[model samples]
Target: MRIFALETDINKIKQKFCHSGESILLSTPYHTFSFFFSSIRELFITIALFVVGIIAFIYDLPMGWTLGVLLFIWVVFVFFNLLKAYVDWLYDFIIVTDHQVILVDQTSIYKHEIRPIHVDNIGAITTSTQFWNIFPFGILKIHLKEGLGGDTVMLKYVPHAEEVAATITRAVSSHQSRSQTSAQRRELSGIDDSE
Candidate 1:
């Protein structure tokens, strides 16, 4: 039963985004560390509010009930903020296909941006690490041609960034080879037509 549901979901995704002869080569969300980093501010705020609520309750302050109400609201706000952060982290993914690379940036439940770059437009791919490689996460940067969705697309906190970059590089080269073969065929056909 579970496998059936998973298959259905996969089919739905393929139908929605994939074209004929196009297959997904790689699809990965940002590393787990990114989720904590993205929601760090909210976590700190929640901790501070919780401490204040505890102190107010312990002192039996005159306005303790009001403070409790305010803290309750603050808790809700923090919960939603963390939810948004998780949603952003989980949904924002980099997908490499045979024909193109797709970046899905989901900032919130209601907002997302999809950037698709054809493999031919990708000029260069590089990876960078933070804090002298202390962390396992790294960044993947793809340099694109002019007028192709700005200059570069950077994916932060990517686990195994080097592997992902290599996969994209391979995809780009594969696309170039296929394009050359097709162009040669077209040129040969043109000669035959002229003859």
Candidate 2:
């Protein structure tokens, strides 16, 4: 899939480091119900319009006029969808290097908020899949650490959220393990110096 936008600092940091010794993985593109449902609805609308155009031609209505109307509607639909896709793509809740979680939310070109949470500091991870959001599909509400402003991140509508949660948990645990090992190494080095 095409990457529309990546965190600038994240990119810069990765380039500066020669090697992390472990691969940094990011999650797949996720969208809200509104996005997926609208796209699906547009497909149906396009099909219905095609059928109507054929019917108009058969009934001796001006074929050119019918086609023009359909074209106009399609163009409008596409324009709106393009905007929606861009916004949805920008609004991502991301985990980076298993050390940080960043939520990039864009309200407009000039208005936005970027929240960063340290994975080591995270207190808890909670997930909720609501029935209404399932609509034609379900979404996972991933809440991380209470009391931290905007600590919760939604994966929006996705398939197999349990598997995704498992993946995230593993990443977080791995980071935790590395941190612990580093602390222990530091302590051992200090003891050797004391001797």
Candidate 3:
């Protein structure tokens, strides 16, 4: 699967990072049902338009138009709705790296918000699934530390949330450990000591 025309290869994405030694542990987009169901209103509208077009074709209106063209436009409308949903889902993503948990939210074609929670700054993680959600689809909330405004990264309609959370948790732990060890080494070298 591709995401907004971008290749979904985790390694390729990791390599794209400007900072060296960054490794992507997990990368995920919203679940398939999430994308499809989100455009329900558009789907209904497209269906209604298609029915209208068919009616128009059947009635042989005063305008000279063939059934083929009507059907083509109907298909195009339907495709547009689907493509919109896909583009929205594709552009937004949740990614866990060795250093942080990143939430890439694309609100519009030109608007994007990239929030990265450093491993040491993550306060908590919460997840919930709707009663009707049969698959591993749910919402994920990554709470930041108190000093950092205590903001939460809210991700909706995520798939395999349990695994994703675990991946983030593990990455956080590993990052914290690495930071701690590096700090300890600095202390040992008297770099943190007041001379």
Best by TM-score: 1
Q: List the global CA lDDT of all models.
A: 0.79, 0.59, 0.74
Clashing residue pairs in candidate 3 are none
4: Cα error in model 2, Å: 8.6
> Order of candidates by lDDT, top first?
1, 3, 2
Summarize candidate 2's per-residue lDDT along 1-195 as a digit string, tens digits.
223343424344344332466455554344465455546767777788889988998899998888999889877876466565556554543444466555555433444555655666565555556575444334555565656664556555554555556666776898889889999999999999999
TM-scores for every candidate against the unseen true structure: 0.85, 0.57, 0.74
| Comparison by lDDT, 1 against 2, better one | 1
Please report how far candidate 2 places residue 52 from its true position, in Å: 3.1
lDDT of 3 by residue, 8-124 (tens): 443444455425777778888878777878788777877787787778867886444555666577667666666657766876778788888777665444455566677889988
Which candidate comes out best when scored by lDDT? Answer: 1
Per-residue error for 154 in candidate 1, Å, reads 1.3
When 1 and 2 are scored with TM-score, the better candidate is 1
Candidate 1, lDDT over the whole model: 0.79
